[model samples]
Target: MDLTRFFADVDAQPWADLHHAYGSAADIPGHLRALAGESEEAASEAISELYGSILHQGSVYGATAHAVPYLARLAAAGHRTEDLLVLLGGIAEGGADEGDSDEAACRTAVAGQLPLILARIDAEDPGLRRAAAWAAAMTGAAGQVLPALRMRGKTETDPRVRAELLGAMAHLDPPGTAAEATGAIGAHEPGEVRIVALLACVDGGLPWGAAHHAAMLSLLPANDLVQDRLDLERNEPLQYVVEELLRRDTDADRAAAYTLLDAALRSAVPEARAEAVWAAETACLLSRSAPERLAGAVEALAADPADVSSAYSLLAKLGGRAAAAVPVLARLAGGEGDPADRALEALVAVAPDRAAPLLARDLERRPRALAAACGSLGGGTSGTPFPYDAVLLDAIRARLRGGGPGGNETIRLALLLGAWGSRASAALPELRSALPGAPRAVPKALVAICPPEHRETTAEFLTAAARTGPADGRLPAAAAVRELTGDTGPLLAAVADRLTPGGPAVQEAARLAAELGPEAVGLVPALRSALSGSVGERTSPQLDADAEIAAALWRITGDPEEAVPVLAGVLAEAEPTWMRWTLGRAARAAALIGEAARPLVPALEGLLDGRVQVPPVVLALHAIAPEHLDGPRAAALLLEAAERDDDAATALEALVALGPPALTPDHRRRLTDLAERDLRVRASGLEPGIAPADERLREQAREAARGLT
Candidate 1:
């Protein structure tokens, strides 16, 4: 508790080299120093930033551990007990979106500080007691913390504090605590108090599958990512909240949880429904089957004016299981708004049969709806195909022939026709004629709609648009000319003549040329010249120039040899503030080189020092050299990285590549659990936005672990 001694003890660690959310923990010393300085505003700001960085969202980083002992000292010396306790609780929880190993690392970090934290659980301040109680639960210091929690629960007069203590006690799962948990969460308790008690009860093996399951039915979701109306600034994402619950729910409460979620979905308030959506999404992940239990609620909400858009999204997430919503979705599709197309997509997802007629009728009634309708038709040609291709194409052609179609509408029609590829070939001449009016979009449309021969002259039209056609249209024009023409020579000439030295379309021209890849191998020198200035000195807008130039060099040369040294040197030091843009492109180029990038490994490892953009840096490592983890320092990071859900499979593959000796029992268990979840996620058809590559990575991780198990 001696502040001076604590500061010296903490300061001795090489804090600068540690990693926080954005970058190095080097800046952390300055913040901690400010906390002990005179400025209250600076101290408060330091605290706020700390929450975002070390304990970002709800995930803990290695720097998080390094900071805790110092923070514990600060709290003990009475600098800021209440807020510090709250932050300690969150850090102790680590990142709920990850596996147990990651959380265990967090607990391990705080384990030595338990006596200091536990002593505060029964403090005089109710808020301090409440926060410390939560922290104790999170740290799993049941032996030291539980007795204090039980003592505080029985005698604490303040309802909120007592409820928090009860919750912590329940989470520890001692004798007679179930009855205490139920009592604490009763109607007499406030919603906030009930939420704490219920989560603990659920965590303590209490089944939420009971018909009148109080825990699931009550407790307004406070997670910032899911609910509104609450403090949006501080909540962990819904994914984290759900993972925390599912990971702890040994009670198999999926069915009853679904029933509660159904009720939450129908709640009149939007925020409540959002929370329900979070729970529903979690249900799909945990159940290994489609969440049809919430179908009726989703169907009912699909028509609710306040809920329509989100409801359609939920149904779309349900995929083929929510077939019951088709009629409602079909009705909703005819109505205009953002939700309408989403509704149509949901309808297609379940019942493409009914969706076809609905789209056809809507197109007939609303010619302006042509783009949205045609855009919906094939859904990139991979979704439900254009069943009524004849009807939809006829409507698109008819709308374009009209004397009054607006420029934007014209562009939409042309683009939709282009997306059809060969299917819209017959309309090429007409599309070509319309190019004079809406030249910018028509050419890109022609790129896809017209045969290469018919579209060759369309580049001239796009070039003219690139010179004028309002402000925003030029980039699209240059992009289109580059794509539609499939000819890089003229653009590279323009890149030299007009695009460089700050022409209106300079960036776009360079970007378009980069797409030319090895075909524009001649432009390598020009591209390399653009990357000369110090990357750290570059601003955000200027960073794009560096990335494009780097990408162009890598793509055109089929090697990163030229750009690698410059990019690696730029990223070699503590990254500049605007470094994410450059870092991503650099890592990408390094990834292209793969194992050949051995020389660049040390530089990428510096970025993975648990700082900002750790994922990409880790990915870069995975791409360049999974074998790098065989070294001691990188190997330790790999074990922790494997515990993260996002980083898990990739990290597992890396560890497995190191062979059976590196594969521990804990690692194998987490791997098996994640593999099972990936299968469930794929079967449900709701990636929610995860790439298909994630599933492939999951499979690869399993194959890598095939023999070790």
Candidate 2:
């Protein structure tokens, strides 16, 4: 496969001036030569370099347009044909700047080589045929490519190749995809081919009828057969079906999804049943009724001893909503080993009160269950802490007395005892005995659990830790000393030292300095130094540190000179696409400055339309420029953010700041609905930790509604 014609004018082009992800494109010619060389090893390395430099992370560059023609020619000559076709397809998908001539040129260059791409769709190699199908559709020359794909779909012999052809047809002609897919989903086609056809129907927005649903259920656990040969959206067909149905959010669509999943869960095959259970978890994350509808079915699976681990994980994610599974979980918790511990964890998340006695009974054997109880019940703002059972407290005391708890277990024990506050005074001697081994974790617990008579001793111990302990323990110790003795002397000096530029704890130090107010007047120079020391383009953390320092300086010195400009810059700058939390921090600092932030009103107003930005922007405007705010606009945005759970607590706080007059009758009704709904406002994705935060948001919404009335 000689490439003399392909490289005829490659060197005549000025590759140095053109740019890729790696700056100069001067090395692109060598990579291109090596990619077509005889050695397979060199070709592999060269292609990887080309992907890194020219099409880096899916973003095409100026040099990518120039290289597309050569790539297409190499692929046609049957040299790494499949790999080159895949690369050409990716470049043709337009990762460059929208409407840029370079992006247009890249697409045009690929389209010009459609003859080569179309020829490979009939190649003897199934892999080459699949790649050719994908590349042909990506060129966007539908007038020419669609007829060829429709022709190939009729005669493709391999099931995998047929599935690829169906996907390509769906991409080119969505309205026509349903008709083409219907023929492919017949009894004659293979299981994987029918599954792809079903997906194509969904992708085309065709009405899903009874036939389609029946066909999908017959192909249970198609995950094994529907290999990701073409890099389709999801690897599991059942999961893809459930997600698409629930995303439509219509009652009829959801009903159809529930029927299919319910049948799959009852299958006797272990793998099929497990896959169905996994798909049900996806449905639960998407739909509010999924936990209630599927909980009993999942609980039935828990009856089997071997299936308990997977069932428990999903049940724990369901949280209190899976109350029906508590009986089954309770039975499993009585046994021994990892399954029992897992059952206890699920029980703790579902019903902490009932799980407490069980935790007390097996405290020595179930470390994970104990940790789950501490994590789920110990830290939230709205829920009750883990109840203090006499048996549980005694077990903890035994562990401390015998010196059995390790570092992490010791911390958990301290936190559990601290939650009981003065009620746990009976265990004070044991806590003190365990203190020397875990000084950093124990002092905070000691200050919380100790009575007034013992506070002086605790304070003395903290003072010693503050002055001479490890770097990680010093500031926390000083903070505890201030909490116990009301002495700022230790904390003030600690804050000044931690506020040094490039320090590890500058954010926390600056926040503590703000709490000291005028007492921190001596630390203004340090605050100012940290504020201006950001290098290059400010990153998210750098922006956050600046916000904290600015707030500290304003509180200490009451001067807007240093504080206002940084806040203004944060407000005026483009929000980082990655971190949505940075602007909220800056908005909070501006709110603290109050009237000094008057100059930032326009910048904050410009940020009103963003969902994540609304809560903080509303609060900032309320503090600095309330008269200029459009109450209805702020209220609508706040309600939208609250509904989507984009920082629901902050949105409710903004609602409170907007006051009752901002909320119309409709707004109040919606707010009441949010307060009283059984489903959590923030339930998205698979994070089980959001349960407590959702409870907190619900309580805030209830408080906001009542206060408004």
Whole-model lDDT per candidate: 0.61, 0.80
Candidate 1 overall Cα lDDT vs. reference? 0.61
- TM-scores for all candidates? 0.60, 0.84
What does each candidate score in C-alpha RMSD? Answer: 9.3, 4.3
**Could you tell me how far off, in angstroms, the CA of residue 514 lies in candidate 2 after the best superposition?**
2.0
Q: Indicate the residue-level lDDT of 689 in model 1.
A: 32
| Highest-TM-score candidate | 2
lDDT of 1 by residue, 533-637 (tens): 654565544555555566566677867676566556545633544465466556665776677677888888766665334545666676788876544344345
lDDT (tens digit, per residue) of candidate 2 on 540-647: 777788889889989988988889888887665546456467788888898988888898888888777776877988899999999988897789899999999888
Error of 1 at 580 (Å): 4.9
How many times do residue backbones clash in model 1?
Answer: 3
| Model 2 TM-score, 2 decimals | 0.84
